[model samples]
Target chain A: MIDSRYKEMAEVGLAIRIKGLKKVYRLGQIGGTTLQEELKRRWEIWRGRDDPNTKIGQTARLTGETFMALNGINLEVRQGEALGIIGKNGAGKSTLLKILCQITAPTEGEIDINGRIASMLEVGIGFNGEMTGRENIYLSGAILGMTKAEIDRKMQDIIDFSEVEEFIDTPVKRYSSGMFVKLAFSVSAHLDSEILIMDEVLAVGDMDFQKKCLNKMREAANVQGRTVLYVSHNMNTIRRLCDRCLVLDEGKIIFDGDVDQAIALYMGIEDHLKTEYHFTEESRPYGRFSHKLSIERTVIEGVCDDPRIGQSYNNPSFGYGGYCLPKDSRQLLSNYGTIPEKIIRAVVESNDTRKKYIIDKIMRLVRMAEQAGQNSVVGIYRLSMKSGSDNSRESASLSVLRGLIDRGCTVLIYEPSLGGLCPVEGGVLVAEAEEFKSRAGIIAANRYDPCLEDVKERVFTRDFFMRD
Target chain B: MTRNTYYLDKNVHFKHISAERKWIDLRLGEVWRYRDLILLFTRRSFALTYKQTILGPIWLFLNPFLTSIMYSLVFGRIAGISTDGVPMLLFYLCSNAIWNYSSSCVTSNAHTFTSNSGLFGKVYFPRLTVPLSQVLAFVIRFSIQMSMVLVILIWYWAHGQIHPHIWALLVIPLSLVQLGLMGMGVGIIISSMTTKYRDLSILVGFGMQLWMYGTPVVYPLSQLPDGWIRSLSLLNPVTMPVELFRYAVLGTGTLQPVSLVWSWGFTLLALFLGIIVFNHVEKTFLDTV
Candidate 1:
């Protein structure tokens, strides 16, 4: 027979237990689009087909579709364990942390938590620009579900740790970005929660502050008997703070155990990637598409072995501009939740402003056609980056396409590769070239081709409009 | 520690998180627990909105003052509309005092989801606290504006242009509550939909303007002679409060028991439906947004 007290002691040591945890999302099916698409997707879902706009490779196991962000993850965290999670971009690391924080609900799963969790997913979770720093301390502390009395108790410690006590009365917006981060860090650091979750937040501030923060986190887990979960690309922090570690790839937990072993695996996985290329023979033309390499360009006369070439994929999995220069730069532009850097946030805002500028141009053209009391449809020439290719479902153009769709614009697709069939379940596919040309008020294409005759399709379409 | 009744229950589970797909999960207890957070949000709203402005709370009073005076001039003088045998300025101000509170409640609560998506995305707390704070935050602005109505009401009462009923004291607060319920209910329902169909945000501004015309803001319910239009006006959740508030303070407006029943019924129904929609949306809105 088992002793009851020992069983109780073991159960008490367990801080969190997750079983078969799953979080599924339809790829690029963010549902703030027009009502027509929303209802159409729902109708398809009701009829037992997958959600129409989801990417092809994602399995549609449930009624809708499944791009499982966290796929059936089972993890047991003991009390006071400092666990480091390392993963490549889009590897479900942040998603798991978000679910643990209960910021978002999982699609399916059971998560049992032993105590309160204080998470610093971003440095300042709720800092109002107009409010002074002293007020923001109360505001942010309250937002973390801390009582006013609790914040009042730790007020001096937080103010001192941030090292900006002189400007504590000034509004946070006036503080420099680094000072803002330090002030925000201090408030979250003093939370006194049973579980502490930090995600790449220590990459900023001067070295002294970073070192101080690292020591605080280590103290929280080791001395304070609080469970800590840290996710970072910086392996050094993991080595210094974590005793256990986890490595996630895609959506599943690929590795878990000793911290050093996880770091080696994470670094080794990146180093093992092979630089190989396969390209079309016609793409080599006088080095016009020089930036895009054709396989035979330069093996450089006995400098290296012949490059892997002339092999086609079994099926199309990627399209034009899949990855851009300074790889992960484009990925960083698209992924918002992971990039917590305040500077990156400004870049994201500028990217949004650029998209907005483009969207305004599209709207202006469509409205000009509508001035005479007629409904005119805007045409999207192709979603694929290259003209002939078909599998750029998640292309850069999709953001602009989605933006137009959001503004209640009627979009007709003219991708010949789709063969005028239903490329998207409810999307209109213009099969007849003459009809496509006649109906479109303005056409928007990502890349300029001889077929377009102008850099912007809307400008080309307008010139065509003037001629007719 | 004594509060932990389950401490000795062998399976002392503290928290459980899963895909909660229930139609109704108000979590009122959780909202109650985070009541301090709600006040803090309200304090931030008070501190932030008034900052960097020369005249702080004065603008709160001035904004409503100008709007009500404009309504009185447009409807009372320009359109030659009657104000139920009371001073046109007094009637409009009285109606506005009640009307603005409820309408502001609806407008503010409608934005609860979209405006706070930043805070909502990163942290965990009862999301209801944000809307409740909005509901509380506007009360400061409302009270300052409501004082303007009070001062004007005294002038009319002293001049013997209006009779002040004892029921003025009782019905005023009751009407405020009813209007708050109706507005918050309708607002949250719209809030839930705004995450997906952003058209609702645009619709809300124009829709509230039209809804004001439906209610007896500019003209009294008594102006529309006894018929289906009057009955429809009675059924409008806002009409009862506007008319009753006028009758209470100025002592000149329509009074019907049936209209009272209809108004309360609609208010309660909107509030009930609002809670269910809001509770469900709080969990699932991030997926769409």
Candidate 2:
């Protein structure tokens, strides 16, 4: 609940007051987590038995493993104040913003918000591909809960600010990425909302546009007297825009006060917390891979120690696949077909070669199993598109499975989501863990699970870095 | 800086968000507040669905026209089923025009969660606006198709081949309300449910197909032998609307006033329960979906 001090400060012009705010997400299974163990833990608690996952006199809740994304946060924001929230990755920065914006519900708390709220969690919230840019402006404004009169009144100003007057009637799908973000930010900036919740929205577009957005946001908070809650990794933006700051670490507020001191404390924690080791050129494990660059980039991109642009990580797999990765890469390749491009073409082709590699591995396993007098039924376990999610629409495992089946290999699927019939043609459906383990001579799991411990020797997986 | 006390005054509106513990949270007033959004969504559905097509909304007419032609060929000619004094083409066309309206409302909104999760996650609006707008738009589409059917019926009436009661006008409007609410209501409930149980989505696709067969869309209630099938079909909420509209225009199908009242009651009851379930699912569907 809100403490006495916060209540006192919030007595007059409280724009927001969050009390005992907590959000617990069911964390994705890494290695040993399972539904069976959760049930066992519940049964033990019923019988007054010692919990298997916890130490004596310690407490652990039943159900699958849960992560406290936001833990017992109590805050009060005054109207007309620009508050910056800074945090390392997975430090609940976005989760807190998401909650404040009402994009999600808190697991255990209540929040009181004053005035009409608008969020800029992404630059373009719902710009339909086929819709004209002008139509999307009205669409997004309506989506942001603005009245028709408000949109109609601000239409000219929004178009002028976006500088897309030449092609305003053209579909947004035809716009360059730069023009798209520009129009999107203008729509949000022109909104007459009293409270604005932004999550790294300033990271889009060029430097000039970023400066223009920062100025508009400053004008919104200062001249218009609107409350602003901004979350970003750019310390420079926080130092320039926010009058006050709050630093969150591991779901708890570590420092909350003046911007300079908060930045100092946040940076100090980032720099000193993680252990680092220096290695000579000769002392590295692999000659081809840089031992220092990966860790240095991870520290910089993740903790914001030296935040820059285009932060991404690499991991080898059967193919680079996810909900958007394959689709986006292929789309980019097609769009660049007239222009001479090498990397874009390679990005699309590399995935195919990786699938070929996986299929060859499965074929070798099948032949070996046939020589050993086994059925050689290759079982595929789970085909979630993205790690830490249940979506399986465009995952690498699905492509790999299709390749194996196309090559005339016996395929069996053991997805728990499906039963009675297999999802793919020419494959056996095996739902139960025990039955699948016994029937399939070779098991291919995209992500490793604890049930595969006994059959680990027979499992062929390309999950090099087992992190979701 | 000095602050204004009036900004945070207690009487001022404060949006309170919590773990919703209410049995019913329809938020109809909030949905009404977003009427402009509903209108825009309705306009978008009409504009985008048939964009870049050769015929555009003519496809709307072509769909029912072709379906009725097939029905007349199969059920009218081959099966030798009676149309109860109405011409075979007009009977099939009239039935399809009304039945297809409710069916479109359901099919379009059935995958609301799956199709619009990206939009839903990024913004906050009354989620009901999506389905409600589709229902409203289909009502307009249904009227256009109904007008075409009326033209055909007029040709029949001029020839002294058919007679329609004046009550058909009133019954048609009432039937639109009955069918729209029930279609959208059932659609959003299924959309909410299928977020967690995706298998339900697959079932809903075929379920609509099976539901049409169960109703008297292809065959008349009078055509069925007096047994469980006829009695079971009578209990179907769709039966009253379909039969009432047919009887109102053609004046020959089996129509029971008491059963019509029962259908209205069932529609209102289902619409209410569906709204509650949909509202409950809207808050947390992002997590499961």
Give one digit per residue, the lDDT tens place, for model 2 in B36-90. Answer: 9999999888889898899999988888899999999999999988988789899
Model 2 C-alpha lDDT per residue in residues A315-364, reported as the tens digit of each score: 23223222222221221211211111111100011122245664554455
Stretches of candidate 2 exceeding 4 Å from the true structure: A1-11, A28-63, A273-468, B1-11
Superposition error at A314 for model 1 (Å): 57
Error of 2 at B177 (Å): 1.2
Instruction: Give lDDT per model, in order.
Output: 0.68, 0.68
lDDT of 1 by residue, B1-47 (tens): 00011123444425667675666566777788788898998888888
Chain B alone, TM-score, model 2: 0.93
Return the interface RMSD of model 2.
Answer: 6.6
Interface RMSD of each: 5.3, 6.6
Give the per-residue Cα lDDT of candidate 1 at B198: 82
Alpha carbon deviation, residue A445, candidate 1 (Å): 44
User: Best by DockQ, which number?
Assistant: 1
